[model samples]
Structures are given as structure tokens and as C-alpha cells.
Target: MNRRTIQGKYEIFLQKYNEGVKKYIPIYRVKKSIHTWYNAR
Candidate 1:
């Protein structure tokens, strides 16, 4: 795929992932230091 297409897809994927995370987990409860296992798909 082209760079632009890959970038657009990545943004969409990230937005959806963020929304999913917010839906399941409270924003204030998310600790970056404690949750180092989370990785970008």
C-alpha cells in the first residue's frame, strides 16, 4: 500500500482503538507506567 493509504488506515485504527479503550477502561485509571504491555497493532 501507498504511504498515504497506510497512514490513513493507521489513524483510523488508532482512533477506534482509543475509543474501545475508553469505553472499557476509565481514563483516570489508565496508568502508563503500570500498563506497559499494551502495544500498537
Candidate 2:
């Protein structure tokens, strides 16, 4: 309802989003590498 509360919520949301992305980065990298290898083959 207040500006500070809204900002805090936004920060929390960003933190969770970043963490989720970080967790997925390795999986995505692996998939990308496999795709590239297959394409080269």
C-alpha cells in the first residue's frame, strides 16, 4: 500500500526471479552446448 512496502515487494520478487534464473543457467547452458554439438555434427 505504501511506497516502501511496494519497493520491498519488488525487490523480493526480483531476488526470487534472479535465483530462479541462476538455478536454470547451468541446465540451459548444457542444452545449448548439446544443440551446438549436434548442429556441428
Candidate 3:
């Protein structure tokens, strides 16, 4: 594979990875907040 093609593939992978992270981060934040509140009690 050429450098350009490899870079393109990497970019696509990064985009998909970011999308997955974005989708899950809110859920993660909610869980983290709940955990912290429970621990604070």
C-alpha cells in the first residue's frame, strides 16, 4: 500500500473511533458522576 492510501485509511479509522467515543462519552460521564455521588455518601 502507498503512503497516501495508508493515510486515508488511518483517517477513516480515526473518524469512526472518534464517533464511537463521542457517542459513549456522555454515558460515561453520567456513570462517573453517579459513582462519585455514591462514594461521597
TM-score of 3: 0.50
TM-score of 2: 0.50
Q: Write the per-residue lDDT of candidate 2 for residues 9-37, one digit (tens) a residue.
A: 89988999999998887753344345554
Query: Runs in model 3 with CA error above 4 Å?
Result: 1-4, 27-41
Question: What are the runs in model 1 whose C-alpha is more than 4 Å off?
Answer: 1-4, 27-41
Query: What is the lDDT of every predicted structure here?
Result: 0.79, 0.75, 0.75
Tell me the TM-score of each prediction against the true structure.
0.51, 0.50, 0.50
Which residue pairs show collisions in model 2? none
Model 3 gets an lDDT of 0.75
Clashing pairs in 3: none
- In candidate 1, what are the lDDT values of residues 1-41, reduced to their tens digit? 36668789899889999999989986565555746577664
Looking at model 2, residue 26 earns an lDDT score of 71
Order the numbered candidates by TM-score, best leading. 1, 3, 2
Report the number of the highest-TM-score candidate. 1
Q: What is the full ranking by lDDT, best candidate first?
A: 1, 3, 2
What lDDT does candidate 1 reach at residue 19? 93
